[model samples]
Target chain A: MTANPKGGRYRAWGLIVPTGVLYAVTFGIPMAMLLSASFARFEAGRTTPGFFLDNYTRIASDGVTLQVFWNTVTLSAQITAVGLVVAFPVAMLMRRAGPGMRLALMFVLVSPLLTSIIVRNVAWMLILGRSGLINTWLMDWGLISSPLALMYNRLGVIIAVVHVYLPFAVLPIYAALRAIDPARENAAASLGAPPWRVFVHITLPLAMPGVVAAFTLLFILSMGVYLTPVILGGNFVVTLPMMITDVARNQYNWPFASAMSVLLLASIVVVVALASALNRAFSPPRND
Target chain B: MTERSGSPFGYAMLAIFGALVAAFLLLPLVILCIQSFTAESFLSFPPPSYGTRWYRHVAAAANWREAALSSLVIAAIVTPLSLVLGTLAALGLDRGPMRGRGVLYGILISPMILPHIVLGLGIFRIALDLHIDDSLLSIVPAHLTITVPFVVISVGASLQSFDTGLEKAAQSLGASPLRALWHITLPIIRPGLVGGGIFAFIMSFDEFIITYFLSVQTRTLPLEIFSTLRYQVSPAIAAVSALTIAFSAALTVALMMRGQVISAGRIVR
Candidate 1:
């Protein structure tokens, strides 16, 4: 520690300045503009610079947008729930897997993340569309006379989204599971505690942090989903982001779009805060 | 890694469920790859016949080639720029003043969690006001907003396990501070750098939302794919998806071979 050069601390701090400048220019200023634009007046598709509450008022009174926002929230919760249920077993199996098996599992989970979202969704279209593989095979086998309404609806959107986001949920829970001390579980087992009881009492509580993390992340990521609902939802399921894009791009109503963005950001922050608070309330006291 | 000493029935059920989830993860991609080789012009699964015609179509298509090229160029540029910025930020947060380290770390990593739509709209508004909406000048910076966070995170993780003593020993042995860092520190953290760089390239290359707002005439690969999918479901998209999947598969192998650079524990940390 005594090998420090003169003013090393100053120079060390200086290293961050470049990125700081870049973030300030790229994110900070634009965010300020977004906030300001949210309050600006918009009349007849023309965004004029001024303070106004019409945009917020419209969102509050416009029953359709609220419904869409609620739909987005519900969709996010459903996706998170499905993701957690599917991912937990995979994570457990991963923990029990050999090194080679673990690497292969990681490959399966992470490769989907590396591919573009549209590409993944395109794959889903081929699988889940009304005339997709499932429907085609079912019809061919005479299992059903008609193609199931598998896609072009909310179910399709949820399926495709879950496929894409499942890894995001899995990775954290797996990490959490891996971090658990093996001795505790062994001790519980040695005490004649049943396997199910050991899991529910010992392992599950320890992994709550990871579960909470996964939930928060999946929910946030899901809330911002725009492309999936558009491509997979067949435009039938309108989410908040889709509505914002429509308002901004097609309607040329920047103020209104900004207002919606504000709403989306606010909701995300609120939900994340609530999740952390609930975790705090329910989590057993940490030994650390 | 605790072995879950579950009941036989429970173990059997868990393994079955796990295998099914794995298959579900791979099924769409396998189907899409199969569809890419169809002999027919239209999109169909378990194709009546197989051919490489769609692949050849994508190869010969001018717009597809241009879009792919543009995406590569942007990724190539954004990769190094974000790498340097992110590495510097990580180095600073690791070795610099400790007064606001937690706050700084959170700020640097926040972009990764922020919804892309809000960022896209914000940048789009800025580009419009500055009249630079349809150019690389606007798009590159927008891409950086998201990509830099990945570098900071991955590189920071590497730094967390780094041995500061090596750099100190070098300094004590008469190497300058900067030289010690350059020789002793950077080489050991190369895995993190490589991992972060790969993430940066992929993120920038696959980035669609911000670029969707910023570009009109200059279409990246994802933008091209989006527009193509919007118009009609074509076998050509299957070809493109297959190619991207192949590329990702290759990257995944490369990352795994690098020995846990993208490990779940490191990422969650």
Candidate 2:
């Protein structure tokens, strides 16, 4: 934190050169090509080089494209909201646990991440089927007259999404909650503030930065989500990412797909930037 | 420590919600594991009988064997490359007096922000242009774009808190700069490097989108599983999926536990 020696400059450059050069050539070049190719014309499984606004114009004017975009955005927002609401309490509980128990809990929560998205969603297919576990259990308990359709719908997608992505939401808020000096909360509690009040005034405020960070991450992830929605919701519900893949792979419409991708990426960037800005406004200056 | 100071009613609520959520998170994986062992022809949970039938099918499937090997080979190749490059970048930024370091840092981690589908499309587009599509080599760059960030963030965090005085002390004792880095600095941050390597390997191995976009002739395990599932809902894929889930969990725990104890090296930390 205090000093930088004059001597290590060459060594530093040596260290940075590989990834930097690698990224520039591979990542950098591809991105340039993508930007350029997005304007190219696509016909009969082939693309030709040219400048064209038709790709972007089609993305803008198509009613289905507009609806898919709106739906993706709204679904992402909803998923982000749900994940935060659910993860906040779990994170609070995690912070409340002992070290060993906390580790165990962490392992449990992260187990879903260990499974492939395909596997998890496949499992969801079985679990959310009309005769799936929830429905069957409910029927057994005389809580339902018949099996409820949970798969191949928005509700199915949302439930699976929330379950799969819940850990992303929990870890950040837990980090934020864990970082707080317990004395602040204790101070509020000891001053006759009830548990709810203390948490609202002190603990909740402290963890807000983490909540915002988690929300941003989750929102972007939900926006970019392709596999889970398609696997669970089937053809009926199409998110933009799914649409992009469908267009590129099936329709062989690279330019339109690229245009959609560019727009999706731009929107994600704007939202993330806003979220980070909001996070900064909510949190105090870094102790560092 | 004062987290326990909340009211008893609050603690009760925490316990109830925690159990419910944990169960919800775990139910699917558990069902899959059970369904994989089912002797029934169809994948109905609470199977009529259980056996090793599906497991045998998954093991004997030729395409699955190919896909699994491809995934491992690709991940094995990417892991060390990512570690070396990522460590170097982290070291350069952390120790070096580089201007515009934030910009450089952002550029390195930008892949994390760009959605998987976008990056996948970009890589696919470029690959098609260059006629490198469907090659294992083509998948490498895409995986790196995502995996390298984990290394940067992991090693960078470690380097931030590292006692640089140790490196200086080693140098002062007549160790060369590289020698000091190898003997002193690297040992202290070995956890980060190891952790980063593990994360990179898993990420590359588990990645389907990039693989989906790139690989056609040589499918990864995920691609194969996807195709198999798309065609039919057999328990054979469930067996493979369960095995993969086990392998992944085992690999991560084995690596993490075998490493030196650095609290920051853990994913959450």
lDDT of 1 by residue, A1-288 (tens): 233544676468677888888888778898888889999999876778889998899998989889999999999999999989888899888887778777778877877777788898888888877778898899999999999987778899999999988988888888888888788888899899988899999988988888888888889999998888889988788999999999988898998999999999999999889889968965866656
lDDT of 1 at B230: 59
Measured against the true two-chain complex, the DockQ scores of the candidates, in the order shown, are 0.60, 0.52
- The Cα error of candidate 2 at residue A218, in Å, is 0.3
C-alpha-based local distance difference test score of model 2: 0.81
Q: How well is each residue in A1-288 modelled by candidate 2, as lDDT tens digits?
A: 113556655456567888877777667786777777789887777888899887888888888898999999998988898999999989888888777767666766766665678888888877887777678788999999988978788889999999878888888888898898878778887788888898888888888888988898899999999888988888877899999998988798888888888889888988978997998788864555
Instruction: Choose the strongest candidate by lDDT.
Output: 1
lDDT of 2 by residue, B1-269 (tens): 45545887887798789888888888788888888999878787688899999888878988888889998999999999899889988988886676778887888787777788988888887788788889866788778888898899888887888998888888778888789888988888887887787778878988988779887788898888888776246888888888988886786576547542223224533
Report model 1's TM-score to 2 decimal places.
Answer: 0.96
lDDT of 1 by residue, B1-269 (tens): 25556676876787788789889989788888988999997888678899999889999999999999999999999999999999999998888767788999999988887899999999898889899999888888889888898889888888999989999899889999779989999999888888888888889999988898888899899999999885357999899889988998888778878875345235533
Model 2: chain B TM-score relative to the native chain B: 0.91
For all predicted structures, in order, the TM-scores are: 0.96, 0.93
